[model samples]
Target: MSDRYAPDVQEERRAAIVAGLVTAAVGFTSSFAVVLAGLDAVGASASQAASGLLILCVTQGLGTILLALRYRVPVTLAWSTPGAALLATTGMVDGGWPAAVGAFLVVGLLVVATAAIKQLADLVRAIPTSIAQAMLAGVLVPLCLAPVTATAERPLLLAPVVLTWLLLAALAPRWASPAALVVALTLAVLAGDDRSGAVWPGLAWTMPTFSIGAVVGLAVPLYLVTMAAQNVPGAAVLTSFGYRPPWRAAMLVTGVGTIGGAPAGGHAINLAAISAALSASPEAGPDPSKRWVAAVTTGTTYVVIAPLAALLTAVVVAAPPGLVAAAAGLALLTTLAGSLRAALTAADRAEPAIVTFLVAASGISVWGIGAAFWALVAGVIAHLVLRRTVRAR
Candidate 1:
């Protein structure tokens, strides 16, 4: 009986390792371009962006490892992809890259506060789901359109990337964005300019400088998006797998990770939502008790790959103007669709949602604040006014 059981145990260990590697691969490859693009848009130099990516990977990986080991559960963490998309749309704020770093620090503090203060978490929860989703949908619209716009701009170069994405999406949906990115990266290399001096893992740090505009425009929206889109969904995913993650501990870990990585150029880090399933699900192993192994493997994989951030950043920097955007756009398509569906799901709240969506997509800024902050402002007001009118009626 012991000998017979040994084979099963070995198989489970193998499956756990495979699942972990796949989880890390899918998570990193799919949205890394979006992160790089976001950092660049917010004025991160190449080295700074690479440093940001590297630190994000290291911190989230370390956080996941610590959490999974401590709780004996499969827990995973990731950079806030939607928050990255928000940065891509927000562009450069009043104080530029240092200011953006400052905003990142503020977001980290806010996450810590949410964990510590019930009222703060409640306040985040109180933001109407429809409005939040709408704002996210609106922010995603422009970034998601990159592929379409790139097609017209450089038809020959972008055509293959889009085709690969569409084909893989239909057949192996999980690999779609990653495959598309691979194609784009290859094209970038073939069409490469002199990248002779590019560093293997170029790293840089920027001292954070805070301003009111960055705090309101970048930090506030980033915190909201990270919480609403990543942290909440991640908890739900883990719960669905019968794992009761230590919520406060996870928050504190991620918040501290975010704060530590901020000056190094990382935007934000949080619980992994989509990728969490890769490690926590039955796919990791038949026995739920053993799934934590997969999480450890996943975390280890991320740390191992973190060093490649500079190489990837160099490739993107050397690529054509629209190429990286096209890949990033492909990566975000599903997220955009989901956000849109959620935003408009309820008939009663459709009006406010729409208002939020339009304002965010409008790309407007007032008094140095970006559209995302104002979209929330517009949405809450619309929701309240409409509610009062209905009561009066």
Candidate 2:
């Protein structure tokens, strides 16, 4: 008999379905705008942006499904939200979209190589968690300020959305972000022009264009952020709950997925950090071994939702830019809070973490490299110097 019909398995199966649906809902509602904004920042056309979102959803969905089944673990995959935020802040490069695509491909290959090379993987793991969390917080600061900016600029339109989010967050935290999205959409339809009435997104392949600036500015940084902020933390989350997924295989799937989808505008896909906790924890099912079913269900939900990318892209493009930013900010508030808590938890790392957060939040760019990289470097140097001085004293 199927597991679903088995006497002892039915309850677990139902619990898994609930976990998976909730995870999928939270993941999609939280970061879709960041992806769109990132693509637009790099000069992708509306259809190209939609195609990227669709490709990302489909590839990550497939990767999650394959990895969960193969490993019998809750191997949830996600688009790199931090990477998207990085892209949004990085702005357009010399060769524009084509160059960005080239960077995406390079980042994917780097991830694959990182998995294959033991030392490289070890090096990634060696980066201080506090520094990484600080950098993430720094990168998120500007985006997180969007709600305030949106409220100032368009109070009538954005106020209700923010209020709804706050209300729901207090009452039903898991559903808060999704409800806020609904409020935003309803307001958009009522007040905004219907420019995207019949727009259907189509695939538009971009030829790769490589340059020193694009590689250093976009590719290297994208790879670093994806590994530092997403993959490493995601692994930790799973391990915390006692599921030991095959690390190399998980990286391989994400790397391959990223490379495959780059031509169609996808950036990086990695393991889910926050959302994974939802589907892999005890709340997912009483039996820990059955939690993989939640991940599989989440993956299936992503696949089913991939076709709606055109509609989402249309709505995003038509909506007020500030409103979209506000929604993204609202969605990420919890993540930001968690990152800050982690970054500041350790006393010795707190100063360097603050430095990193400030530099990244400043959004400075030098020699085409963004502030995220510089923030990480500065934070590490501070950490080392301060530690040595303390030892000498």
Candidate 3:
């Protein structure tokens, strides 16, 4: 009798399941857009890009699982959706995929090395949570805005999808999210976004290359952007959820994944921000105590989904852009809203957050890294100097 039944344990397990499923649904939309756009940056043929995205999703899902299991904490893993956005507009301006892959390896190594020393984590922690939250908001604000921009073109195809998402998001919170994804994709495909069912990309493997240009232009910026805009917030998210995972573990996994997938147009791997939050939220795990289980569940789902790299790639190619855009925007609203709320809360830090938000939104560039890094650097300096002057007074 003592060994047979455990109701409390079962309730905890049920909560974990809820967390994993919701996050996975949200991740599909957010992650896919970045993957699709990044492929365009790398000059990947449609098939190759799709496969790369699939590989990325699967890997991150797996990473979320393995880490959560090892730590018995809600240590979630996700692709750098913003990092992919950083790569999308300008990556093609570089040496195409080859140079981009070279840049990817360098950044991956940097993340790994960051884990090797405690200094980086200390530095990250030194920044106020308010500032970190601001950076995160800056990164994700685009997700909410992109859909509006998309509607400027394909309203007919996307309006229905968007409306459907809204209806579901409001009425049936549990099944609505994932169900919206499926319906939106179906509608998009019906609208002829599916470019025929010839769903196979020519697979290729690329070894890492060296690029002094990429080092300063791409790698360093990626490191800064990803660390500030993604990983730092990611760590904070975990902490907010009552778990303390080793930062090294997160960095090491990203570094490894980055290097391994660069040849395939896998640009960056970092702690997921929005999707991870959704997955690890109270919605995902009703019982806060079972959050780890939710993370583990996310990982298990990833493992199941990762291996059919080719098939997964094909599906992305077949999906319509309008559909992807609308769904992604709708799916990620809560994420964007939360990040914005956090950014504006710290009165003293408001100026810096505004600067960061502006720079990132401007999509300007310093070298090759895009606006995300500069926004962080700019905000941090502004925040520090302002604080210093105040203290001096």
Candidate 4:
């Protein structure tokens, strides 16, 4: 018989709801700008950018629902924030937004292909943990620094937001970032900015236009970063929490979602790393079996809020850019700290990890490719050199 009326089950379900809501809020407030900035970098119009955001939310939301239900685990899905950061740094490409959409399609194919090819999946799995963590930390540096810079430049706008975050973080850890986001939204309303007007965002489709430069520079690097920096770590996080989800099936579903969303301006969607823990962790419920409820609730929240993408875009676009940055930085602070800790935990790999972090944080690009790819390359070389030196000694 089902334990539907049991007191423990009821408490677990309630906790799951809270976890899901918190995760959804954090996922939306934290990195939404990176997505917008990335689309803008690739020459998307305001309407197009809104469409992309909506598409991403919808697809990832659906993926989260499907995966959690199919696997009976908290399989959270998210757009690749690091991939978006790479796009932001890569600047405009030839053939504009269409070219970017083409790249997105190719990335989807690559993800699907990786699932089908054991060698490719194994190669991604072979990337050193320290290097991957370092790359993630580096990509997050600028975003994490936003609150510090905002405090200096826009104290009046950012002070309350930071104060709220600090207070909540001390007393109610999980809700701290979301509370800060609430403060930001409240302040944005009080500012009386006309640009904050609400309008429902409509879909805008663009035909894909493939260029060799776009394919090599954007598609390949995007696929690599999403897999290395997001999916792999996401799976590891789940494993750490004792959920052995079907990895290949999850990748296949994400790939299909990515492909479906590409023409509507969505970039890559993958397994979520930071936010996955919010739903999958023990705090979501005492019963491991009931934790999937949190993932389902998160997916429902995303789908419900997808249509409000235009309103959110307006709010962010209207707010003092510094204020928005501050909110985002605050949301990512915990993630940044965790990644840094993971990257530096190994004594032997520490130096190479630092190399990776610095290169990625530098935001330098060469031959139209972003710093993320180069950071991995540099870290690998540093690791090999250091190992050889130790052997000689």
Better of 1 and 4 by lDDT: 1
TM-score of 3: 0.80
Best candidate (score: lDDT): 1
Worst 10 residues of 2 by lDDT: 194-203
Q: Estimate every model's Cα lDDT from 0 to 1.
A: 0.93, 0.87, 0.67, 0.85
- Global CA lDDT computed for model 3: 0.67
Segments of candidate 3 deviating more than 4 angstroms: 1-22, 89-93, 126-143, 172-180, 193-197, 201-203, 210-213, 272-293, 307-321, 347-349, 366-369, 388-393
Candidates 1 and 3: which is better by TM-score?
Answer: 1
What pairs collide in candidate 1? none
Candidate 1 local lDDT, 1-393, one digit each (tens) = 589899999999999989999999999999999999899999998888999999999999999899999998999999999999999999999999999999999999999998899999999999998899899999999999999899999999999999999999999999999999999999999897755356558458789999999999999999999998999989999999998978999999999999999999999999998899999999999999999999999999999999999898899998888997899899999999989988888666689999999999999999999999999999999999999999999
lDDT of 2 by residue, 1-393 (tens): 885568668878899999999999889987898898889998898888898999999999999999998888997999999899888877787688999999999999999998899998888767777888888888888888999998998998898999999999999988888888878876776676766566575667898899777888788778988998889889999999998867899889999999999999999999999898999998789899899999999999998999888888888878876887788888878878878998999667488999988998898888877787788888989999988988999
TM-score of 2: 0.94
- Give the higher-TM-score candidate: 1 or 2: 1
Q: Model 4 over residues 78-156: C-alpha lDDT tens digits?
A: 9988788778766677668899999999999989998899998888767777887788788788877888998998888
lDDT of candidate 1 at residue 222, scale 0 to 100: 95
Best by TM-score: 1
Candidate 2 displacement at residue 204 in angstroms: 2.0
Candidate 2 off by > 4 Å: 1-7, 195-198
- Using TM-score as the yardstick, the better of models 2 and 4 is 2
Question: Backbone collision count in every prediction?
Answer: 0, 0, 2, 0
Candidates' RMSD to native: 1.2, 2.1, 3.8, 2.7
